[model samples]
Target: MNTKLKAMVVDDHPIHQTIIKQYLANKGVNATTFGNVTEALRSLQGNTYNIIFCDLQMPGKDGIDMMLLLNKHGYSGSVVFVSAMDDTIISSLTCMCRPFTFNVIGKLAKPYFEDDIDKLIACVCDKHQSKASFQKQIEVDEREFLVALAEGRVKNYYQPIVDTKSGVLVGYEALARWMHPIYGLLLPYVFLPIVEKCGLSPELFDTVFSNAIQDIKLHGIKHSISLNVAQDNLEDALFSDRFLARCSENNIDPKTFTIEITERESYSSNVNLYKNLLKLRLNGVSVSIDDFGTGSSSLEKLSQLPFNELKIDRSFIQGITTEQKDKNIVRSICGLAKSLNISIVAEGVEDEETFSLLEEYGINLAQGYFIDKPMPLEAITVLNKEKKYV
Candidate 1:
């Protein structure tokens, strides 16, 4: 059995092309070499190659154009560009021309290491052999602007919140789960921080909101959707307007939605953050100080702003069954929320003891892996059908 992948090499340099062709041929690959784009395009029309290698700094038609031409021709294989420029610039070019072509696997700088090329080819061949590959196949108009585009991929998962008093379903927090082509299902902890760091929090938040609204419409359940909005994102005037506009576009009522602002972030003694929270309240969206009691300024700032809800951080709810200090903290938080007419939700209530204790403290809502683990949107649909509302 001959298992060989055909590879096409396109470069103006005779020596580099020869080296690549020889290397690929020696490695049991069917190697074809072309000195220009015309020959490469002609060969592509006549033959099928698993991958193509192109020189970025070509004379008439550059490597980027060749990649775009391959994309325009609907070639499904990967393209690898060789260049003397930095990989970052090539990556940017790839993003720019991604909509036009799918062949550029990556860019390789000049002064090539034979060993590195061998490794790269090996990785490409392995992907071709793998049954489960993470290569994205979607074609967008402007791939360079895809990160800002609204039509990427979306996945919605439900994290249930229960009534601690009766283990009844009160609502579920809609969590936006991204099934990235390269990265598998990512938790909020993994990508949320990175998104925030990259100054893309507003786009990320919009993606989350779009998915949440879709889920609510799909489930047809009157349950509330609690979403986290970064303080910085909320502070942006455009963000506030766009968010409200998106809600209007999706026909989601503000009454059934809650925006969670981290207590640690909102209570920084900065007046601007508080002002944004007040704007959220004025918009009729419930503003909850999330992870309450996790910060030193939480209790002091509770009275300073109009927070409609308080979420007791999981740290307080965890190990409460065994520790009196935990119980005391929960009691104090509940007392504070009640005194302020703020709805209290104890997050991370995993055990029966914690649940019962929370109900004793008059905590109205609870969520954790104890009552029910995070579930898919379909599972929530089934659960909603079975739930008997009081």
Candidate 2:
């Protein structure tokens, strides 16, 4: 017999509790119900769960608090947020709480039917398997020489952002990964911060840009290639000139490649940074404000710089369907971009609903797991050969 899917369902309402219990029971899940955070924590003390289906708004402690509690207990189960609150707010909350969160499997809107619950459970199961495999891969990677390999372990993964309505691939983002001989592949989180701490960020940036440029030329990719540059690298005259010269020497049009600076640094205290940016822009390189709206000075930077694109961060885009406030924020950004004639790309479209919502809201460009995950440059070459996106 298949083991029942174990879950903890938390909500203050008795009817909602009954509904979830009946729903889970129909799905062959063994669910424990809790009307409050204290009871939920108490239940957690005695047993482990495979999933937690929690309401966003409860009487006290709330959904966010419950997430923190789960993290504090080291409960590595999946979290499925099921709430009536706006999806955007829930999505935003999820992002805010992600650093301490363990395993968030799904986000289901409230007033959900049995079909929704079943689909969510199925999704969670699929995600659980992928996460397990991914974590195992990371573990094997942890045993390898990530530190030593960081020196020569430059890799680039191309993730496509297509026009939703036209389905045309307009651009690709360059993602970094570290491949170890023994441990397989180490993700950016494993070695990127370490590289920065070890004072190799500039070198790493060189490798990423060089490989990205080469890939663009090798695969005959004509669309814009987005590469992230560290704040420290932006101030280096030698680094910037070398980058420009590489593009010139390779005949790779600087206009087709965008150098992205995170929103945090785009609003830097250094007044001269704008001059550096201006110089690059004058040479055909486009600048982009990455992860817009996470920090202050978004309006200031947007007005001050000649940025060609504004990327709405995934945190805000993840749940715009349900959250009215989130929708408004996205709408505001889209409207602002339209007024400014700046191209907008919504990052992190993980589901069909989110993708559709962005398109409905007039966001043409999108990149995330729903379209594709970041993969090795070799895979991207295959995609190029396949001509999946023209």
Candidate 3:
């Protein structure tokens, strides 16, 4: 009946710490305050708090350092960063924490209002409720991922990519899902870094590719199936040959498939990667630039690489409905792709408004929850049979 939340506040400034503690107290949260990162981290070793409020500008150890240490210590609670820093710096630090596996709840800039603190507390509490669902995902490691790959537990879930104007299912993007014995269904983010680190990406890709081919054949679907390929896969000398051979054995048309290369990974100067991609294109397999606008030097890569499709990143697409800047960015990207004679696919089109905006921008394709969440092969087969996906 208490309904009290456990929280920790780490700040060198006594006044700010008191402010945060008082703010959290008002929200029915019992908060423990610390004046230094050392004491805070030591408390973390023995105590489990639902949320941690970290100050970015602290003496001895800053918030970023504490965040890295939190990951090192395997702290899995939500972290809220409090700083007077610029929005850009806060955004960058928040982004950095995510890759380290920290659950960044929200940020409180300096000169904070009481409403801001209230919002932060509410957000933290809301996120904490869902923490249990993700706790099992945290237990996954490279060994588990390797076992899953070897046991043929990696499965493909297909999300249909539709033509924007016609609303016709044009293709399906193969997303990897691991059928973990204990965890049930695990998304790619849960184990992909480990797969890449353990050099098992190619194996994982092969598993997904084989399943996708079968799914296409089983359903007698004629549309293309796009598979995400890593930089290492492209760098492999025999990758092209192996891929083409698999398609040949499966009796799949290379034209009915696409290889998606993410822009986040650097492939600008990889001669071998370029050669392999060129080989795929020559053999009728199209290449698409995935998450188009988020990466550095995207335009440069676009001009240099022989990609036929440009996927507008989800970040921009998700914002188009509410943010003017996002709309402008999506429009510009669509224009650029059109000028180059490249087809554009906007990812994360989650609403009718966003979909209409994308259509207005002349985006060639769209894919997201608005159309359909990724489905298992059986569901896809049903949809194909019913022809209801349009």
Please name the candidate that would achieve the greatest lDDT relative to the true structure. Answer: 3
**lDDT comparing candidate 3 with the true structure:** 0.84
TM-score for candidate 3, please give it: 0.73
Q: For candidate 1, what is the TM-score?
A: 0.58
In the range 1-390, model 1's lDDT, one tens digit per residue, is: 114688888999999998887777767778889999988899877788887888888899987778677877889877777887764566477657656636455655677666756766786787787723555443322332244335555466777877766778877776766565555565666555556556767777777787777777776857888887877876665655666777788788776678887877644555566666666678887888888976778867677878888899986787477545667878888887888899998888776777777777899988887777777877777878885422
Candidate 1, residue 77: lDDT: 76
Residue runs of model 1 more than 4 Å from their true location after superposition: 1-151, 266-275, 387-390
Model 3 misplaced regions, further than 4 Å: 1-4, 9-28, 32-46, 54-75, 82-86, 109-127, 133-152, 163-168, 189-199, 236-251, 268-272, 293-300, 313-335, 347-364, 368-372, 383-390
Clashing pairs in 3: none
- Give TM per candidate: 0.58, 0.85, 0.73
Which parts of model 2 are misplaced by more than 4 Å?
A: 1-4, 12-15, 55-65, 80-96, 103-112, 134-151, 217-219, 264-266, 351-360
Query: Relative to the unseen true structure, what is the Cα RMSD of model 2?
Result: 3.4
Q: State the weakest 10-residue window (summed lDDT) of model 1.
A: 140-149
